[model samples]
Target: MTPASEPATATSLPIGSDADLAWVRHQVRQFAAEIGFGLVQQTKLVTAASELARNTLLHGGGGQAKIIPLISGPARGLRLSFIDTGPGISDVELAMSDGYSTEGGLGLGLSGAQRLVDELTIDTEPGRGTVVTVVAWATGVPAPRPGSR
Candidate 1:
């Protein structure tokens, strides 16, 4: 397992159009499988990727995602970061709430994606953009991080 302070191996993919959405999902599934993720774990990661990719296209106006394979203190995991340059979210807390939606969506995008992963973090500036990062471990529990609950 990689040391806690070491960076994991990572790859970045651009998400600019509708076609890229499918491609992102495919890439995520392929990578997850390559790293020995089980079928259910792969599905969960893929579903979260799909939702984030769609949000990038429809709301963020296009962005990119980075996939990182991780190992820390005996835990093997995958980390994904979705970044966009469109108008940022105004109310991150509300956006992360389970029943909040501004586009008539079922209001499950952010919260649902959060539930599917071991850890989720979001950073946004109202006029700048948004960056959401999620991580899932093969063991279904993340290694404890300093200052995290």
Candidate 2:
């Protein structure tokens, strides 16, 4: 993984409406596929992206997502950052807890997105807005499962 200080190739997509959700998912899938992510990996990343994008639209009152392709060291990965300037989260820890939702949802979005990625970070301040970032690294060539070889 590349250090946070280092720059990587990135692009931004606006997430202002419902239709943008599909666009976000499509962009993530295409980027993951281009970087040789396996089917399962691509699906997981796309799913995570979908959840975040929806949150950006519905909860945050719309935002933008930054997608960065990471190719450094021994790993290849994609990083996504969702930013919103709506009413920020009042309690991030609770928000991240399973089954805790402010919108009457099942409350799986944040936590589930965390599980699908190698790294997750959330930054928010009440009345200031929020930023949620996630990174999923490709497995590269398949390796034998643990204890299988």
**Model number with the top lDDT:** 2
lDDT of 1 at 35: 68
TM-score of 1: 0.87
* Positional deviation of residue 129's Cα in model 2 after best superposition, in angstroms: 0.5
lDDT of 1 by residue, 26-73 (tens): 999998887678899999999999998888888899999988887665
Best by TM-score: 2
Instruction: Give the Å error, residue 25, model 2.
Output: 0.2
* True-structure lDDT of candidate 1: 0.83
Per-model lDDT: 0.83, 0.86
- Model 2 spans with C-alpha error above 4 angstroms: 1-5, 141-149
In candidate 1, stretches whose alpha carbon ends up further than 4 angstroms from where it belongs are 1-6, 140-149
